[model samples]
Target: MVNLDSSIAFLIYITAVSSAAAGVTEACKSVIPFLATDYEARNDCWEDHNHAARLNHYKRFFNLLISVVAAGVIFGVMGLDPALILTGAEKVYVEDSWEVGTWLWGIVAVFGSPFFASLLKIVEGFKQSVNNNLPPNRPRQKVTGPRE
Candidate 1:
């Protein structure tokens, strides 16, 4: 069975990492105008009759690249193995080793961040709806720990 506390902590950590990556990407774009892909830039591109399609393609690629690099750096500095974190596996090997999985985890974190945020919101809404719909006279159920 999944450990509820650890699972929750993991979710929060990943969400924070994703948010940090996004923040870094935005900061980079602000400092480096070449990375900016805002709506205004798109409109400007169209007005100037530039290759908007190529611009869009490069914009997406750079965004993904920046986020992945940010996430990878965060994970690397923390000395956390993305694969083990995702799988809940105990670390049994050398801690200092850097592998390809670390980079892959960066990709996963970038894409999964939004998904995880939406899931948390959905779960929260569901819980609120269930609580609101319960009979007033009925006592709310208290959750202590995971059930056997």
Candidate 2:
């Protein structure tokens, strides 16, 4: 029996499922900064500190929104793209290499979210190094618990 439902699910899996996953991956890649900060940075939003933080927040949101939508559209319409055509004496198989690649990318991105978050710090460090600037000296605190 040809399972039409299974076939449909498979199509969806390789298409929308992976693509949506990629979107989530992109969001994680984009929004890591909000999570990477220490408590001070978290509180800074309420402190009304200055930076293009508001702009950055918007930028991240749009990037995530676009990436997800684009991935969904691309994968759904293409159904595994950049295919490789292989021909034998009596058979031919067109392989969906692009689909596989995107699938792998989505999976890797999900697993690498923490690494992505820390990457923002590394990038900031490099930027600071290039610009010859350092964060202000913070007070030395001997903290034993959350009260500190």
Deviation of model 1 at 109, angstroms:
0.6
Query: lDDT winner among the candidates?
Result: 1
Error of 2 at 55 (Å): 42
Q: Residue pairs in steric clash, candidate 1?
A: none
Model 1: ten consecutive residues of lowest lDDT: 1-10
Compute the lDDT for candidate 2: 0.46
Query: Any runs in candidate 2 off by more than 4 Å, and if so which?
Result: 1-97, 133-148
RMSD of 1: 9.8
Task: Return the TM-score for each candidate structure.
Answer: 0.66, 0.27
